[model samples]
Every structure is written in structure tokens, then in C-alpha cells.
Target: MSRSRLMSSSSLSVHGLGKRYGEFVALAPTDLEVAAGEFLTLLGPSGSGKTTLLSLIAGLAAPDDGAIRIGGADVTYRPPYERDLGMVFQNYALFPHMTIEDNIAFPLKMRKVKGADAKKRAAEALELVRLPHVAKRFPRELSGGQQQRIALARCLVYRPSIILMDEPLGALDKKLREHMQLEIKRIHRELGTTIVYVTHDQEEAMTMSDRICLMNSGKIEQLGAPGDLYFRPRTVFVADFLGESNLLPAQVDRNEAGTLAVTLDGGAGSGQAIGNGADLAAGAKVTVMVRPQNITVRPAGEGSGRLKGRLTDIMVTGSLTKLYLEALAPGLPQLVAAYPTRTLSDDHSIGDVLELDWQAQDAVAIPAGQ
Candidate 1:
């Protein structure tokens, strides 16, 4: 039991999975697959169906439709215990009455594993979490971070084919949460266990996930590597939900080359829709989504595609500075830009005319919000 007693590389797949609570659709029909050892994060705002999807995969709740497969075996109808998967709950469901070692060994004992083997495996699991000496400590006696490590180690004891985490680090403070993120990454690298992590924290998902599946309204919004989803979101919701975006409504028209031209309305220097934009019908209304970090600020008349505006506010935080400006385009949204303090444009106070512009390629155009 102290040796490699792990399950074979497993790929978890859900086909047409859906769930309901009375008349409310908790989860819409969903199809997803996790390759063996891949760290896929389910990211979305609260009530976006991420938790429902995770619970379905873990067999904590029965699915109303579709099938689930693990390690090439259909397990949709199987109970949680029979699915051979480990789940780390958000509340750190550790036994308050047990010692750390006993808590880690609980799973093995439930499975009727031999005493000697279970103890050896529990020790190995404790060591894997770098907490070998804490085995004798009671759960209530340990720090919150220590208790979390114990919960993780307990999940690791059985070496299930897949591990599902539902906001496992949500309770920890900022510093400890960051530390645990690295720890989880290290364990995943060492054990190569397939992980399906659910969290509403975008930064956390970006830090640990190999890829992210963004959910919205009980359906998958976008699924891809973090950068792909952030940089090139396919839908308006995807663009707005994944990160901060300056969504400027504009008119779109196609050129002779079948390219979309965007016309953003800013007061004096507002650009008109010409045949020079993304792919959209002529005269169609679209929204230009740009990240605050992508915007370059300058004194009016200094940059191309500049939106002349008055500096409304500025914030200087440690190595970064954020600038907020009133819109130059009569109906344009307020402009926001964030960048390194070392890269600040000339010193300009409030009432300074500022222009905000970004490379055309940096801005994504999608239909106006629904």
C-alpha cells in the first residue's frame, strides 16, 4: 500500500448531462470530457450551474439525462462510493473527533483495507502533503491551513482515478489560499490525477487550470485554455464574464473585402463605421470589448483612435496604476486603463484631455448584449 497503488490513467466524460430541482433547471444538457491527468476548472459566477455540473459528475446527485464514463467505463448510475473518485468538499469535511492520521485512513478503513496496509498508505499520503509529523495531531488542534492539508491528504489516500474539488480553498485567507494553489499544483503534477476543480475565482482558475470551462445560465459558455477564453471569447457573455472589459457599443458594416468595420461613437474624434472591421453584416450594431490592460492612454491629439476625454480619477497601487477617464465619445462608456507605474504616460492631473485607444486586433467585436 505504500507503493504505487493508484488507479489507471482515467478520462472522465459526461454526455448530455442535465439536472433539475422541481421546475427549475439546475443544470442544462451538458457534454464535456477531461483527458487523463488534465486539470480542468469549472469557472463561473454563483448559480451559473458550475456546482450542479460538478455534483453530477461526482454522483452526489443523480443526473436527469445522459451518461458518465470514467476510465472508459460507464458510471453515470453508480453511487458516489462505487464511482472510485475522491471529492474534497469546501467545508473540509474532516472528522473533528479523529487524529490527522486517522482521518486520512478513514477511507481505507471504510473500504475494508487491511490495518497494516492502511497505516502505511496513510503515512505515505501524509508525507505527500509534506505533513508527516502532523499525523498524531487532532483536527481541532491544527491551524486552518494544516486542517486543509489533512483534508487533501485524506482524499489522496485512496488514490481514486479522478479528484473533484468544490471550492477547496474558499475558506482560506488570501496568503494561505495562494500557497495552497501551488501545493495543489504540485500534487497534481506528482500524482497526475485527473482533477475537475470548481471555483468562481477567476485568478484561482487561471493559476491552476490547464484549461477552463466557463459556465453561464446552466450551460457551457466557452471552453479552452485560459488565454484563449480571455483573449478571444466567442460570445458577448464570455467576453464580459471571463475578465474586465470595456464594452463600447458601435455600428458594424462590411467592406468589399467582407471584413467588418467598427464605428465607435466618441464625441469629437469618434470613428465612423467603414469597411474595416471583423466579420459582421453591414450596418449591424456591435460592441467592442477591450481589456483595461490593453488600453494605451495619451494626451489628446497624441495617439491614433484616441478618444479625447477628461481624466476623472487615478489610483496608484504598489507597482501598478489605474486611470479612469470621462468618455470623449458623446455616448461612449467611461474609459479605464491599468498598467505598470513604470510605464505611465506623462504626468497629467484631472481636467487633462486624454485619448484611449487600442490596436484594432486587440478588440473583439460581438453583438450587443441580450
Candidate 2:
């Protein structure tokens, strides 16, 4: 069967969605949209409401406020079964007694699809997941990754308009989890089914999502393409949560045209960085965020706008090496610089004083606390 025959996609809209449990708010009034065939991930740490939002979308929980529409049809009050959706959970949720083929066909059987048609579609679903040979095996006979694929296959067999996955790859090992991420992306590309996935893994979100909705404290903190949130984060929390960053406290000296000249706190050094579209006036306190990969380390006095620090640690992790520097200035925090392992030379020692600098554009000056 062609990809179109396996699944049909739909758009999703959430309007002022809110949920609460007694005095605790689970989700704030939130609005979101998932385009037809788009993959969006709800990303956050525990208690951040990503799962709460996913539950509301799946019709597993009723919202305290606002409405939900699937493919522009109101489904806020509908039961989970009434919503044309498929769900894959963290656990495989496969019945131990059922064969792989039977597991895949179970949803079809519920929908009254029987006999040869159910069997054939189940086979097709297994083939789509690249595990057609495992048809006769029970759930216990398959590997963790294989069982995950089977769970996904079961969802696809029903051709739900939208698919909801709540940390479906959470149970796998690191290597297998990464492999499954690519596999799921490939399947999404082929099937074009709208997917609203929830996970707390930032790397997973960066790898699989077309757009990521980062939730915090029962509210969305940021929503955008992974790069957008990484490179141009609006707040300090966004910068700190998505990846490692060197957030230096600074006081703005002046706004030179569009660039802002700032003096690092603790008398580290003076440098310039681009503001995040905020009106950063002279004397205002701000934090300049520089990604570890953006900082360049060189022999002392060899770089411009330099901050002198002692090389305290060198961690080599195969493809990349991380250098930790303790700033010589009393109040400055330690900084980390990441470089490809091949680009680093053995000339530098752990106790050596080094100069660290970065391009102005590579650093973002966000107003303190924002």
C-alpha cells in the first residue's frame, strides 16, 4: 500500500487551553497550532506541563478553560476514542500474549476491519516499520527498540488523522534512542501524519521536531524551530535550558549604533555584543550569553576583547573537546570553550593562562532577569 493509504493527516488548534488540579495549575491558558503533517514536540523538564498539554490534546483530560479543534473541527468535549487520533506511550503497551501481527491489527479489529483486510494492513504496517519478519513473535521475543517500532506500527495501522506520542523513545538505551529518532523522522516524512509529541529531552526535541514548544511552570516559555530557541533565545531560562551557555553579568556602557558595548562584571573585560532587540540603555545590567562553541581560546595577549583565565580542565570526548577556564578576575564565573578535538593542539597545559574571545555577533546581550 502507498503511504497515503496508511495514514491521513490533520491540523490541530488549541485555544486558551488551561488545566488545574485544586490550587495547582497544570497548564496555563495557551494557544497553539500544528500544521497538517507537521511534527511538533512539547519539551520541558518534569512539572513543566508538557505532559499535561499533551493529555489535553489527546482528549485524555478535560481542560479547565478554552477549546481544542482537530483539523478545524471542535473536539474539546469529545472522548479520546471519538477523536481521530493515535497514541504511542513511553511504555510499548503491547499485549504480551498477542503476536506482533495481532498487536498491529488490534486497532483495526476494534474499528470492525476484519479478516484478510486486517491481516494485510497489519502486514503493511509492519513492513513500513521495517520489521515485517517479526509477525509471529510475541512482545517478549522482540528487543526494546523492536517493540517500540511495533507500537508505532500499531498506531499507523489505524490511519489516525493525528498521532500523539508521549516520550515514546524514553525506554530505549542511548544508542537505540538515537537510532529510533531518525527512524521516526523518516516515517513521519513518508506518512505525512501530523504528530504532536511530548518529551523532556532537549536533544531529542532538537533532532525530531519541526518546531519545539518549550514549557516551564505550566506555561510555554518559548516556541520555535530548535535553532531559533538555541541561537536567539528570548530569556535567560531559554538560553540556559536548551544548551550550555556562558552567561556573563555585564553593565551596558553604551549602544554604539545597533551594537552594545558592555563591561563584564568583576572587572573581567569590556566587549561588545548584540542585544536581543531590547532597549538596553547605558548603565543597565544585562547578561551576555555566549555558547561554548563560539568562544576562541588562544595564548595570552593574542586575542582582542580578551578575558584572561587559567585553563583548569580539558575534557576530550571523542569528536569534541571541552576546555574549562577559571577567570583570573575575582567575580567572573568559569567559562567553557568547546572545539573539535582535531583542531586543538597539545601545546597548552592545564595551568597555563589563556585569552578567550568571541565575535560580538556570536554573543547575545539580554537584559538581566529576562
Candidate 3:
């Protein structure tokens, strides 16, 4: 078998991509650029167009209006086989009748390579996936992880230029999933392949991806590295959906020095200000979102900008304690704080009045009213 060495493309670009089923639009016009050798994961809830984009790129489905380019070549309507892309699915599609050796050699056979060459390539691929010892075993005789590795070996046998993985680890147990996450990351680094992966798990995306394309409502909400998306999300949906947040409604208040002051209103602890003398006159009804870990809890009344709340519940999770507090005001939102166990000297019980304080820079003020 003549092995086709995988070559890296400059980038994969999707322009004006759209997909529709009858009257309903499955995906709106979407544009994305993935750099060569970059691990870009598409993350979203179900029916959010993540899978649609994947299918379109894989040539499994057609785009209503867009062109996909790889290394400056148009591949929008190319057949799957001609696209030179490797695909790994949620289910490991292995042949029960064939041994792991034959299964890994299947792609090379389909491309009309045979006999000694095919066998040699299959052996090499099994070695690449660290499954050389199990080459003679059938799919039914192997563990789930072994079978998955065989599936990956099959994809790599053809040495496709790009690899597309659609929730490939969704079936594994938590421990196995974490282990395979590292395995896949290692394999990707060794092969230096351009990979487009899809998953709904935020932690998985944050752990493995070089950049993440976050989707919502059939469109891309934001595209950035994990830290950027977590700390500097541009929209409310991106902030609220990516992680846990305490979203308090605030309004922009301009002071005499021409600075922006964000005011939260419900009662006393309601008003907070940031960018005191900056030029934000947008008057946008904004939502100030803070992470649970960002809130500092002191006794009752030491901090200057303090809120009064009664401890509603405490959850101890070995390393840290999750505290839930209800504000004294009738309609103010409940606040959640995560404190390291080492941070607290005397453990406070429920119903104790606690003061919650945070620096203005710790929370981000999003645009008014989403």
C-alpha cells in the first residue's frame, strides 16, 4: 500500500455558511477560520448548529450558501472520500467480523492498496495508536478504549490532511474519558494534524482546545481561547452559558468627572460603580456578572461596598465549600460563593449574616438587557 503522508493546510476557512430544512433554518450564515495544526473545538447545546457545521465541513451535508476552503482549494461540494479528511464518530464503527489488524487496514484497502503493503501500513497504524499487541484481536475481544484506538488508527491509516471528531469520547466513563482526553491531546501533538472537534462539555473544551468556537441559536456566539471566553466574554449568552455566574442587573451612571458608574438597584447593596471617570455614556441596561469564586466573604460589616445576606446553605466538597446566601431584600437574587476550605478559620453555620464583597474589576459588566 502506498501510504499518503498527511500534509498540513494553511488554514480551513468557512465563509457565509448556511443550512436549511424546509422553512426552518438549521444554521445561519457562519464564518470561521481554523489555523493549521490547531485544535479547534465547536461547543454548544443540542440543536445549536455545531453538528451542522461539522457535517458541512466533512462533506456529509451540503451548505446552502457558503464555500469551504482548505489550503486555498475550494472543497465545498467535494465528496467525503476526495476531501482527504479523517472522521471519528461518537460510536466506534469497527467491523465485528474482522480482527483489529484488518479493521485498521480497511481504509487502505478501500483505496485499492493490497497484500503486503496494506498489512505493513496496518501494523504501522496500530503501532501509532499503541495497539500493536492487539492487532490479531477482533473488535468484540477488545475493551472500549482499545476499540476506540483502533477506530482512530483506521482514520490515520489514510493519512488525511484534516481530522474531524464528532463527540468521540461521549460514551466513556468519567475516569476513562479524562484519560482519553489526555491520550487524544498527546496523539494530536505527535501527529500535528489539523483537527476540528465537537463536544458539549465545557471542561473538555477548556482542557484540550487551542481555541474554541462557541455556538448558540444557529450562530457563533464567540470564538476565543478558553481564558478569553471565560474572563472576557462579549455577550450575555456567552457569559451566562459558558460557566456559573451571579448576574445582577445594573445601569450605567455617569458622574460629574465624566466617568461611568454601574449601579445595581434593588435596595442598599444594590448600587456598585466601576470606570468612575472613564467615557462610558452608553446608558445601556447592563448585567454585572461575577463568578462564584470571585466573591470575598468576610464577617458582617468590614468592607466598604458590602452586601448583607444570610447563609442559606453550605456544601462541603473536600477541598472547598460552596456557600449559598439569600439577600435580605425581598426580590434580590441569591448569591453563591465558593471558598477554599483553607480560607475559613471558624466554619460559619447557616443563618449567620455574612458580608459579600468583590473588587469592581472582578466582575464584568455586559451590555444592557439580553
Candidate 4:
């Protein structure tokens, strides 16, 4: 699908992209269509090919096979210079010898944009990053954030439609890294430029991107809005990697009315079939996945289904409290519960016995996938 009609000059579409180093695959077959003015993040761990994919689109590295279209023009074989896209590297890569002004003006000068216009563009670039007064200083004179801004300014000076960022904020301290995330997001909104950002930080991707493309190995694991990925992960890997989860083994024994009768074990003793109009055959095995925050803890009471457990650990993490429990029964798995700290009546200590419960709606059965 071409984004030409909907995207401005900054929109991009990629199809069947793959990269290989001899027999070793760096990236598998992939397709991604980024809307104009959208902030899409390529999120994955190291060796997941997120950087390789970004390089392929930026024309920094060629793909073994695929097609790349930017602003409706086929540029699969175009060199990086001809792609007309701005790129920011992890190291900033600012020219040490050039003044801030000259570094920002390099792209314009290379394109034969001369004299008064090039200098003016450079100055405006500096102003956009709020460092206009430092134009005369070289890269070494600026702080890490300033240098990064200058690199960003250099990339934006020529007004490229697409901007590819590879861990541009990775070098900064935590506070500064967070600050730059907002700045980058604000810049993208203001320019309405298509941005393809790469990062291994889940929080960063969730906080800054309009959508996230989660990759594993050399292929895409899942792609969706951040919220969708958070709430409805499709696989065990997706469930475990995106955030904390408690996976319980469940077996479907029967379907009555709209609910399923799932026999759950390993701290999932009170398992009940839960879903809207779900129908499944008996004797089917599925994994019941639940997030920690969804489970509630209380003292043992009269209930048809509840597990007895000893509080093995209590971790008070400011906003929330994490409770790790060891089930008394052998067939039950160890139970983990996370809830708002304020919800607990008494401060829980190690060795305290507690009851764990949850609504069926809070859990989902993940059928095996091919």
C-alpha cells in the first residue's frame, strides 16, 4: 500500500524487505507502511534486526531483497545521498572540526544551496534546537544534548520528508534522555514529518511512538498501537517480553452457555471459562496469561475456589506493591500478585498466608500458534 496520497513528502512504504550476510539472516521478509507525519518505532532487543531494517530504509545498507518507496517514488536501489532523508546516529556523528553553523549547513552546501540561504538555514536549524547562539562553537564546545540537537538540526536543515533515528538518545543520562524523547516527539508533530525511530527500550517506544513494531530474531513479532500490544499480545514471547505476566496452564473441558470450563492448575485453581460467546471443544490445552496488576490478594475466606499460599516476598515499589507467594499445594504454580500499595489493609511481611483471586475476564487463553 502506497502512502503517497495520504502522506506528505515524508511518508514511506516498505515491502518484502530482507537482509542477509551470506547464509546468516540479519532481517527476514518484512513489510511496513508508515503514514505521513506518523511516529513509528522499531522496537526490539539487540541482534533483532531493528537497526538493520532502519539502515535498509535509510539506504545506509542495502537489503538482500525488497522494495522501498518514499513519497511515492521507488528508491530501493537509490544511494543514501539520493534518498533525501535525515538520519541521526547513536554517536551524534557531528563533524568535530566544523562550527555548529557549518555542520548544519553541510547538507545544504553539498546540494549547491549557497551563500546567504545556506547560512540562514543553518541559523534557523540552530534556533529550532534552541542553540542558535552557539553557532560559532564547534561540536566539542557543546554538551551531549546540544551536540545531539545539532546533529538533529543538521538532518532537518534540508527539510527531508523522512527522518530515520537510530538510538539517538542512547548516549544521554536518564533525565536528559527522557527530556530529549519529548523534544523529538514535539519536533515530529511540528514538522509533520514521517519518522522511523529505533530503540530497545520498551518504555521509550511506548512513550514516544504512535505505533510500535516489535521484532524478534530476524522477523517482526507483532505490530500495533502501543495499547493494543500491551493488552492483547498474541504469543507467549510477546506476553513475556512486552511486560510482566503470570502464565498458567489451562485445559478446556467443556463449553456451557457462553462460558468455558477450564481446569487450571499451578496456582490457577479457581479457573473458570471466561469470554463473550466463546465456543471451544473439550480437552484443549491453552495458556492462561494475566498481568500482575490484574490479580487481587486478600486473607483466606469462604470461597469455592481460592489458593492458599505463603508470602515469600514483598517488594514495595512506590506506585505499586509486588507480592510473591508460594502455593501450599504441589500442582499449583507459585502465585505473583501486583496491586496498588494503598489497597492493602495491613503491611504484608514474609511468611504471611494470603488468598489470591481474579475475575475470569482478567485472563485470556492463548492458543498455540504455528
Number of the top-ranking candidate, with TM-score as the measure? 2
Top candidate, metric lDDT: 2
Computed on alpha carbons, the lDDT of every model, listed in order, comes to: 0.83, 0.92, 0.82, 0.81
Compared with the true structure, model 2 gives a TM-score of 0.97
Candidate 3 local lDDT, 36-64, one digit each (tens) = 88899999999899999999999999999
Badly placed stretches (over 4 Å) of model 3 are 1-10, 254-260, 268-279, 342-346
Clashes of 1: 7
CA lDDT for candidate 2:
0.92
List where candidate 1 sits over 4 angstroms from the true fold.
1-7, 253-260, 266-279, 343-346
Q: Using lDDT as the measure, name the better of candidate 2 and candidate 3.
A: 2
What's the TM-score of every candidate structure?
Answer: 0.91, 0.97, 0.90, 0.88
Ranking by lDDT: 2, 1, 3, 4
Root-mean-square deviation (CA) per prediction: 3.0, 1.5, 3.3, 4.1
Residue-pair clashes per candidate, as listed? 7, 0, 4, 5
Candidate 2, residues 1-370: lDDT per residue as tens digits? 6777888999999999999999999998999989999999999999999999999999899999999999889999999999999999989989999999999999999999978999999999999999999999999999999999999999999899999999999989999999999999999999999999999899999999999999999999989999988988889999999989999999999998769999998888988899888998999999999999999889987877468889999988889898899998888888899888885466678998989898889999989978
Residue 299 of model 3: what lDDT? 70
> Following a full C-alpha superposition, what root-mean-square deviation does model 4 have from the true structure?
4.1
